[model samples]
Target: MIERLISLWPARTGAAPIVPERSVAGRTLLLLITIMSFLSAVTLGGVVLMQKSAIAWSADVGREVTIQLRPVEGEVMDSNLRSAVSLAESTPGVASARALSIEESQKLLEPWLGSGLDLTAIEIPRLVVVQLSDPAEADIEGLQRNLGAVKGASLDTHAAWRQQLNTMAGTIVFSGLMVLVLIGAATVLAIIFATRGAMATNREIVDVLHYIGASNRFIAGEFQGRFLSIGLQGGLLGAVMALVFFALIGTAAGSMLPSEAGAQVGVLFGRFALGWSGLFGILAVVPVIAALTAITSRTTVRRFLSETS
Candidate 1:
């Protein structure tokens, strides 16, 4: 089977496969390659997840603002909330403004205070959700100042929080890219060492083949075919393992997350899938890794053969 695969590369059938069976050192090298490939795939998955999260965050940020109407001594909270909603609705750039009912606000507190507490006994701020036609056209400062007529009332656009989330996701992607680059460099170095070791171990076999008039291509082809198969096998195993891990993690996290926050976070990563593009990329890795291994093996053999002659 191995002989046939090697023969597919070079048409010349003169010399047999020179590289020995997978030894301890060769298996160890394959295992190390698999681990590195797995890490690289995981880094790629993180980049996708972070990118989706940032985009989801940006979309949420663009649509809405919140106004909090604080309860004051003897002042009517409901009336002030109505006045603020009216002002926001009438504003030129405002799309919609609706105040949350007291019951709805109590539900928001349920996660923190639990169901046992009577929310009515405590003084709380009224929240109004304002949707914008265009955030750029909205005079948010003017709206904030207008709301300030009611003591303790304040406007929060959430711009700072949105900007920070975007920056953080971007930073993660940049760091992941750097990690991927380092992995590629390590892969190259590993291949170089493996190729050198294989040649050194098979030195006597090579000289005997050369004495019998075997061509350089014949010897190099044997090694290249062997390494290429190893690389493809390792790359496939790593990619499959990575895809499964991310999918399982995504499912577990979604199950654990709070309903609302989970919905938002899930929208970004969409249940930890790589989709069509990611699958295609993973498929391409097999060929790419094989090619890299073949090239490295061929080059090492050719250079060493020349030096010996």
Candidate 2:
């Protein structure tokens, strides 16, 4: 076998690429990489959007506190509301306190209790919205203690809701990272299989090169270069497709803005906007994919050569 492969060695070196320029397997691998890249980009974009929206929501919720006055058998609702508002406004770090009218409170409950029903007979609690000059500076415990003295008045700092939001955001981010890691592992495995297949197809050529004193590093470099190009091509195409997908979704979200559904979507995604950092983050995947492909191919080739030797 050694003598046969030595005889088969070409007289001219570097006449053509060691790996075939194109093949069915190459195209299939390209398609796989493209799909992986697309999914990865979409996941990253979603994580960024959710993170920003969650932060904004937490900040908005933190800046305001609510005081609810429940109806007492003998106490006047209007008087209790006024006293609560006055107490809140007098507190340090309180920006402004406004008590919602009965009509306004009824509107808030309309979605849950249904419209056209008489809320007057329900004996619902009235709310006083208290905005803070700075959330960090506000003395929440003191205000809560003071509100405890008032009849049927309670202060809600929204601390529980904010903590839940933070937990949810963290969970989402961790899930996204796990997904990315899985995608990377899958890509590496695909490249390893592809590299071995390429080596098998060009077995005779590789043997000849080895017999003719060609180094393993030289052989590995050729495969690495080929796969790197494929990685870049696939990654760029996938990234572009992801961007287009986001654009279409954003346009649709914008059109839905006038409707009730649109308002809900706006609250969730905040216009589906990925800022400049997010865009750059998506673009950065191309080089990373390319590097991963090259490294995986080189390592695979070197391992195959060593095993055969």
Residues 1-309 of candidate 2: C-alpha lDDT, one tens digit per residue:
544554576667645458888887799889999999999899999998899899999999999999999888999988888888888988888999999988999999889989998877788999999999999888888888889878999888899999999999999999999999999999999999999999999998898788678789888988999999999998998899889988889899889557888888878988888899779978988998889989999999999999998
Candidate RMSDs in Å, in order, are 5.4, 3.7
What's the lDDT for residue 60 in model 1? 77
**Candidate 2 at 299: error in angstroms?**
1.0
Worst 10 residues of 1 by lDDT: 2-11
The pairs that clash in candidate 1 are: none
> What does candidate 1's lDDT look like per residue over 1-309, in tens digits?
434444454534554347866676579778977887788788887787777767777867877999888888988988888898987887778899999998889888889888867877888888999999998898788888787677768888998988888898889889988998898788888988888888888898788667666778778887888888888888888888888888788887689888987887677677776777666666666676667777887888887788887
lDDT for residue 146 in candidate 2, whole number 0-100? 87
Reference-based TM-score, model 1: 0.73
Evaluated against the true structure, the overall lDDT of model 1 is 0.80
lDDT of 1 at 254: 85
